[model samples]
Target: MSDSAVSTSRALFERASVVTPGGVNSPVRAFNAVGGTPRFIRSAQGAWLTDADGHDYVDLICSWGPMLLGHAHPEVTAAVQAAVGRGTSYGTPTEPEVLLAEEIVGRTPVEQVRFVSSGTEATMSAIRLARGFTGRDVVVKFAGCYHGHVDSLLASAGSGLATFAVPGTPGVPASSTALTLVLPYNDRAAVEQVFAEHGDRIACLITEAAAGNMGVVPPDPGFNGFLAETCRTHGALFVTDEVMTGFRASSRGYWGIDGAQEGWVPDLMTFGKVMGGGFPAAAFGGRAEVMGHLSPQGPVYQAGTLSGNPIATTAGLTTLRLATDEVYDHIGGVAETLKTAAAEALTRAGVPHVVQSAGTMFSVFFTDPAHGPVRNFEDASRTDSTAYAAYFHAMLDAGVYLPPSAYEAWFVSAAHDDRAVQTVLDALPAASQAAAAAQGGAR
Candidate 1:
């Protein structure tokens, strides 16, 4: 809790910078947004993380949404341990790969699936498949919806969106992103206008299904329906990038919640995060006609030595199998409790905030009470992020860990029970007070 104690993490960060970019493998982990030394996690179990100094905190970031069953869960650990005994990587097909693929196809009712190493790989391959299948170059993506760091997909995206501060990353050529049209999230008319102009040349229109990157902004009512219908009418493929929302949002991911409820299906869906149970596993799949274009079947080629690594598949399979109806219900209940507690505290503190959610994923946005609603990136950007940074540090000091940036969503896992929820609730008043103080009582 003191500066001297926290300095150990600073020391590690200084050491890390000698070899790694920005002293961290991931930019956000550097704690640039919150303006503090990043805690070096020694280990995690259930819903708590033990820092280098042995300080424990309730983890709401959940490793950026992969530890849905919680870090080092027994069943998942057992599965991974059992897998390690056999081998780590086979480079050849294994039973777990088939089983995992079957499990995914069974849950989502999509056609065949292709396993990949990361969410970025999944989205990248999905885009290639879309272009190959449609013979078009343009891909439409929503502003503030991150589809991984794949060059074209990174344009004007969120999550690491504002952090990198480039209109697009430097490595990607201007011409490559020329076909990557970015639109405002939850704005149907904007999407329609873009498609109206370039629909014929657009291969696909990809989205987050539920916009989680920009602080869990849900699609405006009928927005996704409009996207699906518009894509259909324009002869463009509708691709749902559920890398973060997959499994964690619900058993079948955000598209399941959004699509099943709205009676529409995307041409392709990319999955990762909870599906891999914290391993480097990911997948992309959809209509047979579209997927058939990838390797051994068609001209479009994509392959990875670890594409279907047995260890990752085993962990993923076990995690998915355990995400039963009861688990989902329990997680949902926990989310509700945390949401209510935070909202109640903010309200009582006279702080203006909005808690957006889809299943177990949520984020608290600091805004003027007059803002009322945030349906898109434009609305989400209007939030007082400096106030959020203040609240974030206060929560951290109180042993509640939230994502350092306002753009990232807070995740709840099945392991988060009454105690974890209560910890967050108890910490909220002080955090809200800190936010209000930082904003000069503007709330």
Candidate 2:
């Protein structure tokens, strides 16, 4: 097909611009960083996306890390369909909510879990509960760690905020973020210094279990464990925001890689993405002692109109049930293959790059590893986004879709079979060359 054949998406984007802010629901989806028309997807199945212009590409974003089993898995779709036939939403308590909550508790260290409609809600409510429980006014978050777009967490956040180069969101009052201490991601010294100054006043310190939003920057050895210990010492709750890493990174999430092995658990945890089975379900939970502070059981009040909606819960529960060790094994194998292939291709093309991972989740950084791992947002920001934009467009042209921005993880799923993986491999050499030839950020 000719390049002009894809004009349908351009037209749709133009129409959307008139009605929607930035012509996209999410900031990153607008392709502003990449400088191209974002493909308007009509449908996705298994590991492929079919765009409105009738071109099909192997999907690598996986709805930004929710489609662990890949898009529209037969079993998950069947569960959601059966749930829909019963009824869409019922504000009343449902069996699926209890079952889903139980599944989460069984897998992680949480004794109880509370459902929410989105990751932002989960993190927002988690922070509120922490503040109320500790009776403290301050929160501490890592600079590159994103815990959704919650006003407090958005201060110096990763993901979209980092991708767009926003220092901190404008509308969020300075007072809202004044109490939020932003520190470097893997720097124990910075975390220690901040805690030494404000430990007693801190309600919670939240970090991504593994920093996926800033392109899969995994925690340094024992970094998360150290944070948990410090929080314990300082009487502040350690909140692990696993919205992107949960289930997709591993069967039990990044905690399964670190906490499960190291025998340290967070005081609180937030989850979303794969647990919802491609629906809008998320949660926050921890020890029953901490969770008891929320709602009718305690003074801290948090409620949602769509909290524990039946259909969403059903989808989440079913997805969690089907996420066995085999699913994680398959995803891991695919990620390993792709990571190796991408690194090799970049090296062959004489492109300076670094590949990083947190279990099955990973990303190829456009910066050289000589600068060291991207432990914080500053390091992540040093990436060659212009090189990546060229690489991304080349891959898109080769019928393989990559994340539109350099600071996002390239997600793989159990559905990324040899066929899908081969498509990506076939596209890599040319993409790497494009990246090598371009002057990053000069465009």
Q: What's the true lDDT of residue 389 in model 1?
A: 84
lDDT score, residue 12, model 1?
90
lDDT of 2 at 308: 88
Give stretches of model 1 more than 4 Å off: 157-167, 440-443
> What global local distance difference test value does model 1 have?
0.86
lDDT of 2 at 171: 89
Cα miss at 51, model 1 (Å)? Answer: 0.5
Residue-level lDDT of model 1, residues 1-443, one tens digit each, is: 56677787888988998989889998999989878889999999999998988888999989898888889999899989989999898788899999999999998858899999999999999999999999998888888888889888767643332121224777876656767888778777777677767779889999998888888988877788788889899889999888998888889888778888889988999999888889999999998888888899999999999998999999999999999999989888888888888999888888788888976788888876577777888778877777888899999999999998888898888889778888888899999998887774222
lDDT of 2 by residue, 1-443 (tens): 35488799999999999999999999999989898788899999999999999899999999998898898989889999999999998778999999999899999889999999999999999999999999998888888788888887778633422121223878887667767777778989878887887788989999999998888899999999999999999999999999898887888899999999999999899999888888898999999999998888999999998988988888888888988899888899999999999999999999888899999989988887799877777888889889999999999999999999899998988899989999999999999999988855732
Query: Per-prediction TM-score, please?
Result: 0.95, 0.96
Q: Each candidate: what lDDT?
A: 0.86, 0.88
